[model samples]
Target: MILTRRALIAGSAAATGLVYAPALLGQGKPRVVVIGGGAGGATVARYLAKDAAGALDVTLVEAEPAYATCFFSNLYLGGLRDFDSLVHGYDRLAAGNVTVINDLATAVDREARRVTLAGGQVLDYDRLVLSPGIDFVEDSVPGWSLAAAETMPHAYKGGAQTELLKRMIQAMPQGGVFAMVAPPNPYRCPPAPYERVCMIAHLLNQTNPTAKIIILDPKEKFSKQALFEEGWGKYYNDMIQWINPEFGGADVAVRPDSMEVVIEGEVQKVDCCNVIPAQVAGGIAAQAGLTDETGWAPVHPDSMKSRIDGNIWILGDSSAQGDMPKSAFSANSQAKVAAMAIRGELIGSRVFPAKYSNSCWSLIAPEDGVKLGASYEPSGDRIASVDSFISDTGEDAALRKLTYEESFGWYAGITADIFG
Candidate 1:
């Protein structure tokens, strides 16, 4: 119920005064520099400080003082949750003795083992952990770029863009069309875009019943394909349409200025368009030179140590540790493993074999939630799924309601685990 981090910290230093200090490592503790404050970075920082009991200095460098989680942002768009509820501050983490630095990490000097911040601050670390989420891949979607985000809002990264998309959807004319250009594989949150479609449909069903929802997806198949399709048919009727590659979904272009989508040379005007282009490891990860040709940082299957650099570990969406979907749950799970490994190497704590797990839940209609999960272990050079489970199609109403409630519990529990 308390999630992995809290469950693991039962016997450790659970309460401690906050500390902010210079990034130098010679003050009787090995310093750790974490380059993102999302689920992975925050979890690892908290774990190291709590478990180490001041034996290590953990400094988390994140640009945002408060993080808006992309995990449940769809609920906000659907009017299921408030925007404030999705935003979390770093006060708890700062109170837990992890030095929180609000600055953009601009460069990583691997040979010198120092990080340079945009504010002209330098941080030195014995072990550097990069969890810098995802960045859009340039030219992945034709005629779409970061500059075009304002007109065609991706809304994939959470926060303002999400709010913008919700506003755009709300402003659509009656019986208008809502179009979503779903991302290809290896993007953050495999089922998120589809879940967004469901949430938007839920919103539109009440406000604009005649509003049609269209999905132009590049992938042939998606996560929870059967479950989503079942829920769509049952709740949305003829309100939603999905077009795959054979139907020009793969070849697409968008004109944000005109609010038009071109599919296989067929142009269509839409009231709202959500373009989720292809993505790569967040820019900072690639800046650190920890990423491979795949545009994601490669880590060892067991410890999450960067395959390119032994002194650095990568986590979450930035990491390409095979078989793990880039989700918050996977990041939290991987953070614990990395924290334990870092402690064992730096301060002589006991190290155990890495065991990881992740569960992703999506809401279709109200009280209709579906989930998929897997237990993983190191297999050869990758983290292989050992066991897995998913919600079955045509599950009873009570069971589906229970699954929805379970997701609520998981969100609260995981946020506490990551932030506190």
Candidate 2:
């Protein structure tokens, strides 16, 4: 369980110190500059460092000192986990002999094989991994912008935005209205906005029972819709109302000053709103010429290498690989394959066929959880799901609690895998 960097040190040590041997034929170790030290980037960096021993010089560039995962932020909103519980540092990856840089990645010079940092540091690399997650499409929601995030919070990203949403939920007026505008398809955590609504309702039931939640969704159907509806009926009957696109859910605009949501030309007052808009690959990907017109980076289905630049790879939500939802698990899974392929091409490491899997778990109420999972492999031009599983809607409370417990274990295991 202790996956330390010293475990990768090859050959015997001398009496004075260790005499390490390189795995590659080069003046120095083959450099790998990973941008966005989240699930995908961090996991790849760690895997390369561990698997390659002293052959690869891995550097992870991340602005934040610690990453607060958006996956379980809903649990934090529901008071199931503390804020600190969702946050993870890079200490484990650093201990794995990876250079963990605490700075922003500004740009990627694909031709030069260099990445520029926010602090004017140019990092050259033999290979680059870009997994910077999502960035929103500006003006997708009328009158909603980054500045308006203070008033109408979009807690899609983790950290401060999540805390802001939590506070807004707690600050709701007695018997007030809480509204949520769900994002369009092909975004990070497909079922997350609905889960956040459930967590908000759970908090409201504990604090103010009369408060209502209105969900304006752009899509007609959502991930785990049947399961969420079942849980909502069982736990919070008549407390939540979901309106889909056919019912004017898609035609909506927000006015933060008046705290009004205009849906289908009908104006309604809401105490708070969680507005999640359409998203694309992170800025760094677009800047690096890795992304296409679809706003996501296109990659080879097998190894996740960029179609535009072979030396760079895309992972996680930023990657437009078919059949994979943009979740932390997907990113982590993709990272391993990319790491393996990169190592195989760079060094003399044995490579295997690419396989990927992901499971997204959502909490409907306290001790009530449901999950959807799939296993995928490379097809002609996409990663197609070969098998799938999901939690049943009619499962007993014991099973639901067990599912929730299983999610906790996954979080622990994945964080360890990525960080270490």
Candidate 3:
């Protein structure tokens, strides 16, 4: 008897490590395979399926069954929100006719238009969407690596790491020191590290009031610097300190084993240390040969379609689409544009001009919140900021409280939009 690859994969699906049986390829409908199920991939998949109305076969392959959003995770760290609140499952998407595969995508063959999963199954697609998000750059911070994450947690991704950092903070001895080695620019979220510092300070104020917080930043100025500093002075009352490049923040190293931070030649021991290194597009994007010298996948500003390969689209933090900050709101906005473009190309749906907007809201204290945002449109090969706005320094307490409440509403709305 002769056996084909398809027959072999089907017959030995269990033995070959296929967690979910491979979907039938070459269906009458055009296939869309989306890898990564965060804000970008999830929103795109949902949009395509709902809009196509059975005209397209959409599959989402996410490594984790449940996704923990990094956007509002700082609130959890600050004891303002619970960990469970940040987590979302894929069941709703699966129920809506989107094939939700809980497995890791190991490889992609552009010529064959196939994606190979770690579970040994292959998915053939007419169109592919890559939104695998950010990964740490190796050696970006000397002596800090994935192996050392257990000791000096980055907590920048989501879920477990965020919880771990909170636990470390709660366990700190009285008046102990908490240190953070912030990352450089063009990161996942420009304001995340600073927000993390604010959240940690908020937590320590209640639990360990005497504890000191230190921020060793490589950049001279960070997102909403004045707002955060003002909040620290008003709320934290000098409990937090920021060390910039002029004071050895640029030249820094870490000894995870000893929980030590070395600024220039000076070494300091701390009760907890959070090391956020430089970042790049996720490994899968590079493995698929979609990324460029910038370590990010370049996409057309208007359509979010890959510039390297027309059949693929890149969204979220993984995409280099100029002017847009790498935030969940930005990813969600890009996904909508990509969904429209994909539908138009595959099934002749009407395509419209793409417009994008993003807002990043951060909480400094209990009811103290600040935000920065911008609108963008395609200009010359890049997305250019059309207009921008930010909360002013020394805003009245009522406005700040309103902003905090507005963020809560946004969190609920965006999560529903992504997961549903």
Candidate 4:
């Protein structure tokens, strides 16, 4: 009886930690186990199932019953969309071929090529795909931990936290203060915190016009810095105050009990706080020993295959690939490459050369949007940008509105591509 990694993590290996059916290995169709059904996992699972044409046994393991995308969550926060619009289910994924398992994947046994769920179900796989997304470094903030998250919402991962933060904002007193403790470099969404500030300001401007936003960013510049600054000047002039590390963004702490935010040992009471800490690969990747010292899984840029375990592929925010930012579009693109390679290995299919692309758009105000994106190819050992584009700082309203509308179309197309 070997102790499964799941039992060790759950502390359930108190006694025998026996295996139920060790003989289940290599007995069924070539198995493909996909963990964490987010942007990366869902897309890979769909392609593998569809491309295999029922030739491979594809199983998707996701704990959450429904998914609320973190990509467009800012629009919901901005009052531009409803929460239900962002919610999606996996029922559509079961097209009489793919098997959907809704349960927490406690651990992955790489050597035995099996996945152990919390419910005691063991899934043996021929190959594995992990797309667990980002997890925070709890100790990144001195006074902020998971417990304090109730007082200071990160909302970095979409779900109840997003709702909680929205409620806190709506209930904020007039002329109150909103503080955002931004994350360091190598985060899930590079432009998220800044885009969030714009959405928050929009909501506050209509309700609590006197409220002010204070962004304490560790980095001097952020994604869409010029556009965001220009929009802030035009729409909420002098309403948003950004403090870089040069001033006081580096040294910061939070006291949720008193709702006090301390920067450089100078404390000020804030009505609400959004704390986004440093990020790392999803927990399952660490448990499986796929991640390295950087706390992110190292993968081949062309195939998205984990360098540590050739049988497993890592995608989305979990992988430390190349220059690509951790964006939804990037994840979907990477997933396709992985899916194609995996399918080619499982069945005699044509594997094409890998070419990936990504585009990220942010809304500063109503119909006022900006974008930055690029297409990439494998260069030496990393993904190199071949062509790129970004919105000019002084783009007119018409172009900005078109960009915003393009984001909506992409949201619909990508979600359908992932779920359906």
Clashes (backbone N, CA, C under 3 Å), per candidate, total: 0, 0, 0, 0
The digit string of per-residue lDDT tens for model 3 on 247-323 reads 99999999999999999989999999999999999999999999999999999999999999999999999999999
Quote model 3's TM-score: 0.95
lDDT measured at residue 48 in model 1 versus the true structure, 0 to 100: 94
TM-score of 2: 0.93
lDDT agreement of model 4 with the native: 0.88
TM-score of candidate 4 against the unseen true structure: 0.93
The sequence of per-residue lDDT tens digits that candidate 1 reaches over residues 92-180 is: 88777887877788999999999987766777889999999999975988889999999899998879999999999999999999999
Q: If scored against the real structure, what TM-score would every candidate get?
A: 0.94, 0.93, 0.95, 0.93
Superposed by TM-score, candidate 3 places the C-alpha of residue 283 at a distance from the truth, in angstroms, of 0.6
Which regions of candidate 1 deviate over 4 angstroms?
1-26
Candidate 1 vs candidate 2: the lDDT winner is: 1
Q: What local distance difference test score does each model get?
A: 0.91, 0.88, 0.90, 0.88
Which residue pairs collide, candidate 2?
Answer: none
Candidate 3 runs further than 4 Å off? 1-26
Model 2 Cα displacement at 20 (Å)?
A: 20
Q: Distance from true position, residue 174, model 4, in Å?
A: 0.3
Off-target runs (Cα >4 Å) in candidate 2 are 1-27
